[model samples]
Target chain A: MKVQVLYFAWLRERIGQGREVVETEAATVADLVAELRAREERYDLAFSDMGAIRCAVDQALAPVETPLDGVREVAFFPPMTGG
Target chain B: MSEADFDLGAEAARLEAGEETGAVVTFTGRVRGGGGLRRMVIEHYPGMTERALTEIAGEAARRWPLSGTMIYHRHGSLAPGDRIMMVATASRHREAAFAAASFLMDYLKSRAPFWKKEETDDGADWVAARDADEAALERWNE
Candidate 1:
């Protein structure tokens, strides 16, 4: 399945791109993260500290363990700092 | 992302238009100037941001007897002292108006997809989410 993946804030800066489409067979977000981390040094570094990252599947906040059965979009970013 | 300033007076007037609007509460947040700050830049997920903000406003209306509600947030480059965002809630009584406005603010602070970065004389850094902001939501949970 192909999913539109988004990065924001420092994550986008570190990853060098704000958006990308990835074709993956990973069932869960964690699995997908692992696959991306293995791609290059940049992905590995960007995703190194999961504690500082947040994920939203299909525009709704979700856990990293969430399964991507029919998900079309996923976003990763640092915690929001809006007001 | 909009760099335009929001019209607070107009928004307040709109909220208070209805006859039942006995009270209207408005909250505006401005960028603080200090520590040699140069500017602030806000980034947000386009599609998710609209959805989140709408959901939050709807939730506030459902939780209280609000006659009307308005939420306006600005993105892109912003200077210190610029109005970043505003919320207005109208109700039959002051209590409901106040509570709904506070609820909207708390939810917007953490739940919205917007991220802010502070650019200073030394360097630029993404603003960290405060523990207090997360804890503010706890009081609203039933």
Candidate 2:
């Protein structure tokens, strides 16, 4: 399976890229994060603390345990400071 | 164009256009000039932003007796004193209009997909989400 993963704010800066397509069998968002961390040191550093991150799957706010079975995109960022 | 572009009077006029509108509630968020702040940059999830805002606004209307609701948020680089965003709610009574407007602002502040970064005299830094903003949503229980 392939998934499009996105990063925002400092997460985008730390990971050095905004988005990418990855081939994986990951079932949940947590699993996807682990896969990215295993790919490079920068990923490990950016995802060093899971507590510091929030995620949205398919553009909807979702938890780390959310299944990505039919999801097309997953985004990771820090807590929103909007409005 | 910058802060001078938007006209609050025009927006209020539009919001008050409804025939049965008896109360028009509006709130404007502005950039503070103190703390040596120079400018603020806002970034958002492009595809999800409009959807989130619409959902939020829709929910506000459903919860109150509002005749109309308006939200306008500016993106990209903004200097101090620039208007960050505005929310207006119209209803037959002042209570519903005020409550709905407040609810929209609270949700927009914490739930919206936008992120703000501040550029100060010292350096540029991202603004962290405030605990108060989260606490503000507790009353809604939505």
Candidate 3:
């Protein structure tokens, strides 16, 4: 399966790019993160503190345990600070 | 995502235009200046941002008897005292209008996919989300 992955704010800074298409067999958000973290030192460091990270699946906020079946996009970022 | 400033009076006037609307409430958020802060850069997820904001505004209307609601937020570089965003709600009565506006603000503060980074004399850094902001959302959830 393939999904468009997006990074915002510090995550994008840490990852060196804002967007990418990743081919993965991950079933859930956590699994996808695990795959990403295993890819490079930068990914591992950026994802080191999942406690500070938030994920959205297909543009809607979702928990890490959220299933990625049929999901086309996933975004990772720090908690929102909008007003 | 627009970076241009929005007019509150114009928005409120438009929101309260309907004859059925008896009251209108508006809230404006501005960047605060202090402690060597040069400017703030806001980053947002493009498609998701519009979707989240629309959903939040829709939820506000569903939760309250709002005659109309408007939410406008800015992205990109902003300086101290710049108007960051504004929310206006019109209703048959003041209570609903006020509550809905507050509700819109609370949700926008947390649920909206926007992040703020502060550029200061020392350096630039991402602003951490406050626990209070998360706690503020709970009050709206039944």
Candidate 4:
């Protein structure tokens, strides 16, 4: 499946990019994350610790177990502090 | 009533217009100077911010017999005098309105995907999470 990935705040800074389009065969959010982490040194560093990051599938808040099939977008970032 | 650039007086009048609602609670948050920080730039994950906010409002509605609720949050650059966000809740009793309003604000503060950049005279820096904020959320646990 093809997914558009987005990075926010420090995650974007660590990855050195804001957004990208990736083609992956992963079925779940965690699987896709693992795939990204294996891509390069930056990706590995950006996703080094999932505990410090949060994921959103499409636009809704999602857990790592969330399925990725047919998902058009996936975003990762630190815990939000917006009001 | 729903509005973006809300007028506080108008919102209060609307919330308490009818005799049916006996209590109303509102919380208005302004852009703080961050001690000595000059300006603040708030960034949001466009689509996700709205979704999270709507979900929070929905949760408040589900938890209380609310007559009305409103949340207005501003994006982009803001200074010390600017209004950051507001939450107004109306119910038959003060307790529910107050609790829901406060709960909604706390949840929005931590769970919503918005980032703030504080600009000082020296340089700009992203705002970090406060221990107080985490503790505030802990209140819901009890």
- Top candidate by lDDT: 1
Report the lDDT tens digits of candidate 2 across residue range B1-142. Answer: 1224477778878978767999999999888889999999988888887888999999998899888998888888899998988889999999999999899999998788888899999999989999999999999995
TM-score of chain A of each: 0.99, 0.97, 0.99, 0.96
Candidate 1 lDDT, tens digit per residue, B68-123? 99899999999999999999999999999999999999999999999999999999
Count steric clashes of candidate 2: 0
Give the clashing residue pairs of candidate 4, or none. none
Interface RMSD of 1: 0.4
TM-score of each: 0.98, 0.95, 0.97, 0.87
Give lDDT per model, in order: 0.95, 0.89, 0.94, 0.85
Q: Categorize the docking of model 2.
A: high
Question: What lDDT tens digits, residue by residue, belong to model 4 across residues B1-142?
Answer: 1223567778666888678898999888887765777887777888888888889899899989999888778877788877788889999999999999999989988888888888888887787877688789898878
10 residues in a row with least lDDT, candidate 2 chain B: B1-10
lDDT of 1 by residue, A1-83 (tens): 99999999999999999999999999999999999999999999999999999999999999999999999999999999999
lDDT for residue B119 in candidate 3, whole number 0-100: 99
Error of 3 at B89 (Å): 0.3
Fraction of true inter-chain Cα contacts (below 8 Å) kept per model?
0.90, 0.79, 0.98, 0.75
* Candidate 3, superposed: residue stretches over 4 Å from native: none
Per DockQ, the best of the predicted structures is: 3
**Chain B, per-candidate TM-score:** 0.97, 0.94, 0.97, 0.88
Q: Tens-digit lDDT track for model 2 on A20-64?
A: 998989999999899899999999999999888899999999999
lDDT, model 3, position B130 = 94
Q: Which pairs, if any, clash in model 3?
A: none
RMSD of each: 0.9, 1.9, 1.0, 2.6
User: What does candidate 4's lDDT look like per residue over A1-83, in tens digits?
Assistant: 68999999888889998899999999999999889888899999989989888889999889999999889999998877776
In candidate 2, which residue ranges exceed 4 Å CA deviation? B1-5
